[model samples]
Target chain A: MSCWETLADYALRSVGIGERLLPRSDFTICQQVVLIGSGMIWNVYFGVLALCSGFFLATAVALGKASHSVWLRKPSEWFIFIFRGSPLFIQFFFAYFLFLSLKQVAPIFTPFTSAWAGALVVLFLNTAAYSGEIFYGALLSIPKGDTEAADAYGFSGWARFRRIIWPTMLRLAWPAYTNEAIFLFHATTLVFFSGFPAQQQRGDALYYANYFADKTFNPFIPYPILAGYFILLTLLLIGLFGLVNRRLNRHLPRERRAKVRFRPNVIR
Target chain B: MFSYCADPDTLSGLTWLSCYLTTGKHMAFYVSFGTVLLLLAITAPTALLFGFGGAAAARARFFPLRWVGKAYISVVRGVPDIAFFLFFVIALDQGFEWLRHKVKCPDWDQPIRQGSDFVVCDAAKLPLGNAAQWVHETYGFFLAVLTFAIVFGAFAANVLFGAMRAVPHAQLETAEAYGMTQRQTFWRILVPQMWVYALPGLSNLWMVLIKATPLLFLLGVEDIVYWARELGGTKTPRFTDYPHGDWRMWYFLVLLIFYLAFTRVSEVVLDRVMKKLTHGQATAGGEAQRKAA
Candidate 1:
């Protein structure tokens, strides 16, 4: 078959769009590229959704960790510790097993046994914990004069936090948060590789790369293709996060601006 | 493993629980934790060495050597290490076999890559095809060690590169004034000073390495995750005397707790080490210590 037909059939195969069956044997470079690129759809899906939703919890978690009340601080501390201390791989296995047991208990949880819900949940919590720690560190490093200036302006409580504290915390955290975001996207590859089952042979880029590697017994081609896709994804992520970083530090002069360089810390 | 385990059916309550925990598979589960620790113990120094080489080579006078070094460091930057892990294992395995095949069977007629199969002469197989179970496992563990070292070495090289540059220019200038050559200055002055700057990144990398240990199961190693799944799956009465429901979750929870405690302890120890390192230094941490004293 032609490369165009192959692309048409497998371009959206990862999301179960065009192709129902994966290339079985005599795999072409076109099939590997199309299918692996298709698989990137799931990686982006997991990364974007988890990072988007994880942001809110991460903000709350950062605030909780910074709170004066022990009641609030303890849970936040333990939550961050539990998720951050343990490997996300183990967490995925433990969670899948836990979710499986819960599925036995209730029908509503059956979806959680699959990679989409279950691994996303794991990635969500994992990124939140890492980002929360970054934010908490940012919170502590916020200049004391900012809060004092806020009090002089009749800002207090939530108003003070929103006006003075939070933005500065974000600005300070943005570089490291960008790193977290990169790692989180990279961590999405772990989703299908983990205990969570990828239903109907639909999986992320790494999953397809793994499949093609197994079939062709040539890791050279498929793995590099997957890497190329990820490099593009990472570049896109950095460009996107760089925009946010710019907006966050918009007030700062050029010399003072923190550059969003690639600082690769993996698995949080 | 115990006398009571001999007749698990007759046992009950705490005795049954004790016997269940002492079963052969459960013993492997416990041993797997040691495997993780061993991997860390072996990989850490090996990776640090690899990273140091990469970083030094990146700073080399030769352009090709520098390019190779830079490539080594940046290869893991945008890519997932898991993908690298999966790719490298098979690639390296086949690579070694192909090299051996070339040397061992030069007269062989068939091409090595036939369709999807990687056909090497049996004589050229790694560890040999009929090698003992332990030899095969050791070969696998060795491959895993090399893979971990190669991947983490890149991260470490990045950190070490930054640290090497972070060393004060005045120090290197002083070393030159004292007639120290570049290599001598690098080994004696720069390496010593760079560690302080490198410690923070190295510590973070160490934690990441600790967390990455579970991926060993994916490499087909019988690490904790492997044993947890094997032992935790539901066992019927036909399979064993002490039958139980699905207990994989509980086993995983145990693995979870083990990691938490391990990281917590590492954090405490690392903090103390950082304090000791910074005690008389001129960094922010040292200033804080001085003020406190």
Candidate 2:
């Protein structure tokens, strides 16, 4: 078939849209590109949804960890430890099996078995934990002078937190938060590789890359395409985070405001 | 493992649980945990060596060599590691085979990549096509180790490069004034001082390296994740000696506990090592130790 026809047929193939069966033989570069690109839709969906939701949850967790009350601090500590201490790969497997058993107990909650609910839940908790640690560190490192200044101005409790603590925590945490966001996107590729089944053959970019590699007995093409897409996605994420980091550090003097340096070497 | 535990069906309750937990499959699962430790033991030193070489090359006066080292760090950091795992395993396998084909089967001259087939002469195969299963497994484990080393070496190189830079410039200048060669100064002053600066980043890398051991399952190694899924699945009476319901949840929970414990222990060990490395250094940790003394 022509490249256009193949594109038309397999454009949404990852979501089980156009084609009932994946191309078995004579796998064209066009088909690989189209299908893998289609599969990227899921990766983007998982990364975007998880990061957006995880951001707010992470902020709450960071604050909870910083709170003076034992009630607030302990649970947040445990949550961060549990998620951050384990491998994301195992988290995916554990979450999948947990959700599977949950499904058995309550078929009404069968939605948990689907990647949308199950994997997203895992990603949400995982990122929240990681980002929580980052934020907690930032919270602790927030200038004591800032808090003292707030106290001198009579800003107390909620007002103190709102006007002083929260903004400074975010500002200090933005660089590390950007790193977490990038790695979380990288982690999303592991969703399908986890125990979470890709029902209807609807999988992510890595999933389809593996599929094509297996089919053609050639790992060269499909994986590189997936890598290319991820590079683009990662660059886009860097750009987005840079904008936010700039805004967060806007009030600081140019020398004082920290730049968003890429430091993937020191993994969380 | 016990004489009394030979017959599993005869046991019940806690006894049954004891025998079940000590089964051959479970022993392999236990060994897989050692496999993770073994990977760390080997990969850490090998990656460090690779990183040392890369860092040395980057700090070299030659422009092309510096660019090559910089490229190694940047490219690996740029892409997801899973992609590298997926690509390198196959590419390395094929590259090895192609080399063997050229060396071992010089007379055979058909194309290697005819459509989808990567056919070299039978003699050119890795492990010579008739090697034992253990050899194949060992070969795969070796590939996985090399892949891990390459990816992590770049991170280590970045850390080491920074550490090299962080070494006191005055020390190097003093060595030069004393008529010490560049190599002598690097060995005596730079390398010694760099470790103190490198320890924090290296410790963090070590934790990451520990967490990444589970990806061995993706490379088809019979790691803990692999065995957990295998041994935890529903086993029908017809299919096996012991029949059980789906217990993957419990199995995965056990894996989770294993990883958590591994990470916690590593954290303790790494923190101690960092303390030892920082002793008498110019950093804050060293200053704190000096104060305490």
Candidate 3:
């Protein structure tokens, strides 16, 4: 089949659209590209959803870590320590089987057995922990004068945090948080590789890359294509986060504004 | 194993538990944890060597060499490292055998790529296709070690390169004024100062490297993750004496705790080492030390 037809057939194939069965034999470059690109939809889905939902939890975690009460502080500290200390690969494995047992226990958790809900939950917690640590560091490093100024303006408690504290904490944390985000997107590729079965082979970019590599016994093509897609995604993420970085540091002079440098954390 | 472990079917309760825990397979499971530690031990220094080479090359004055170094350093940054791990294992395997094919069997090649198969001659196969089982496992472990070094080396190179630049220009000027040659300046002045700056990042990378040891399972080595999955799966009476329900969740929980404990201990130890290293230095940590004194 033509590249256009292959694209049409398999473009949304990862989500179980268009193509019912993946091309099994005589794999074409077009088929590999289309199917792998289709697989990217899942990566974006998991990355975007997890990062969005994790952001709030991360903020809460950051605050909890900084809270004066041991009740709040101890759990937050342990939460960050437990998640951040373990390899995310192990977390996915542990969570998948945990969810599997949970499904056996109750019908309400049946959805957790599948990759979508189950893997998403794992990624959400993992990123929140990593990002939460970043934010807590930033929260501690927030300029004392800024809070004093807020107090002078009669900004107390929630108003003080919402108005004066959060923006500055975010500003301090944005560079590292951008790195966290890129890593989180990269981490999404592990979901299918983890215990969560790709129901109907609806897997992520690395999943399809792995499929072609297995089928063709050629690691060159599909893996590079996956890499190219990810590099593009990484650059796009940098650009997107750079915009936010600018907004965070807008009041600062040009030279003083922090640049969103891509210091990729190799593993988490 | 114990003498009683020979007949696990007859055993029950704590006796059965002790026997099962001491089984050969369980022995392998325990050894796999050592495999992780071994991988870390080998890979850490080798990757630092790779990173040092990369950073030095990146600092090279020649344009082409600098470009190559820069490329080496950035290659692992954007891609998912799992993809790199997956690719490099097969890629390096094929690469080695293909090189062996070219060297050993120069004249007898129809084609290496026969549709879907990557067929090098029998003699050209890694571990020679007839080598002992241990050789194959060692070769697989070697490839995994190489892949980890390559990926983590790039990250380290980035850290070291930044650390290299963070070494002030005045340090070099002072060395020049002291009549030191460029090589002498680099070795004596630049390199010594570079470590102080590199320590923080290198330590971070060390933590990451520890976590990444589990990916050895994906490389097909019988690491802890591999063993956990193997041992934790449901076993019928036909398979072995330890017939039980699926306990992969508990197995993984053990793996999780292993990592958490490992990281916690590393953090505590590394922090002390950092303090000792900074005891009299000009760095902020040292300044704080001086203030406390």
- The best candidate in terms of lDDT: 3
**Model 1: per-residue lDDT, tens digit, A1-268?**
9999998999988878897988899999989999999999999988899999999899999999999999999999999999999998889889999999999889899999988888889989988998999999999999889888888889988888887898999999998998888888888888877778878999999999999888888999999998899888888888998999999889988999889877776654
Regions of candidate 3 where Cα sits further than 4 Å from its true position: none
Better of 1 and 2 by DockQ: 1
Instruction: Give the per-residue lDDT of model 2 (tens digit) for A132-244.
Output: 89988999998989999999999998999888998999999988888888888888788898888888899998999999887777898999898899888878988998998
RMSD score of candidate 1 (Å):
1.4
Candidate with more favorable, higher DockQ: 1 or 3 = 3
TM-score, predicted candidate 2 vs. hidden true structure: 0.97
Candidate 2, fnat value?
0.65
Clashing pairs in 2: none
- Predicted candidate 3 versus true structure: per-residue lDDT over B114-199, tens digit per residue: 99999988999998867999999999999999999999988888899999998889999999999999899999999988887898
Worst 10 residues of 3 chain B by lDDT: B72-81
Going through the candidates in order, their DockQ values are 0.78, 0.65, 0.84
- lDDT at A136, model 3: 100
For each candidate in turn, the TM-score is: 0.97, 0.97, 0.97
- Largest DockQ belongs to which candidate? 3
Per-residue lDDT of B227 in model 3: 90
lDDT of residue A96 for candidate 1: 94
